[model samples]
Target: MKVICILCDEAFTPSKFQARKIMKHPHKIQICETCHDRITTKVNMQRTAKP
Candidate 1:
């Protein structure tokens, strides 16, 4: 099924396997790989940064 990234608004299609998993959470917004990676990096940086 087709999905759009909530963060970057990018459109993409998920595999049948992924689609099933995603459908399990109908209320949750989907995020693309690019945005997911970017967010993950930012979070990791924050966690590792010196206070």
Candidate 2:
């Protein structure tokens, strides 16, 4: 099924199981892999940075 990334607004097709899970859970937000990876990297950097 086709899903739009909430962060980047890019359209992508996820696997059938993922699509169904997203559909079933209204609170879940869909994000493309690229955006997910970007956010993950940023978060990891923040975690490792000394304050």
Candidate 3:
């Protein structure tokens, strides 16, 4: 499946670190290679539950 970053609010390939270490969760967490080591969704866990 294609992944959307849960940090920078943008589309990107997810990080292997967040994908595996964060359990089997496909949401709530995100990672991207082109995000400058940053997440792509630009979402805040304290507010949104999207990924």
Candidate 4:
């Protein structure tokens, strides 16, 4: 299937194995190269802040 990397902002075609790899990650991830970094960085920063 064709999935864009949400972090690198680069489109890609991931095989079944690759898709499985991404899905196995702990973080909440969605295939979208156009906005992966934005989502990850924003979420991480929010999560790391002192409550």
Candidate 5:
């Protein structure tokens, strides 16, 4: 199934299993792996930043 990333708006097709997982959370925002990874990296960096 096709889904657009809520963060970057990039459109792509997810595997059947992924589609089912996303659908299971009807109210959760959907973000592509790229955005997810980027956000995670940024957050981790901030957490480890010098004060």
Candidate 6:
């Protein structure tokens, strides 16, 4: 199934398991892997920088 990322607005195909989870939970926001990794890296950097 094709899913669109909320952040980048890019469309991507996720695994069947993920698609099912998203379908089951309509309230969950979907984000592409790229955006997810970027956000994770930024948060990690900020956390480590804070002492």
The order by descending lDDT is 6, 2, 5, 1, 4, 3
TM-score of each: 0.78, 0.80, 0.33, 0.36, 0.74, 0.89
Give lDDT tens digits, candidate 4, residues 1-51: 566565566678766776887678737555664375677899999999959
| Residue 21's lDDT in candidate 6 | 97
How many backbone clashes are present in model 2? 0
Candidate 6, residue 3: the lDDT equals: 91
TM-score of model 4 relative to the true fold?
0.36
Sort every candidate by TM-score, greatest first.
6, 2, 1, 5, 4, 3
lDDT of 2 by residue, 8-48 (tens): 89899987878888888969888888998999999999999
lDDT of 3 at 46: 32
lDDT of 2: 0.88
Model 6 Cα lDDT, one tens digit per residue, 1-51: 899999999999988888899889979999999999999999999999996
Segments in model 1 whose C-alpha atoms lie over 4 Å from true places: none
Error of 4 at 11 (Å): 7.8
lDDT of 4 at 16: 75
Candidate 5: residue pairs that collide: none
Candidate 3 backbone clash number: 11
Model 4 regions lying over 4 Å from their true place = 1-31
Tell me the whole-model lDDT of each prediction, alpha carbons only.
Answer: 0.84, 0.88, 0.55, 0.68, 0.85, 0.92
Clashing pairs in 1: none
Off by over 4 Å in 6: none
Model 1 per-residue lDDT tens digits across residues 9-50: 889887787699798987878787788889999999999996
Q: Give lDDT for model 4.
A: 0.68
Candidate 1 vs 4: which has more lDDT = 1
List the lowest-lDDT window of 10 residues for candidate 6: 14-23
- What CA RMSD would candidate 4 show? 6.3
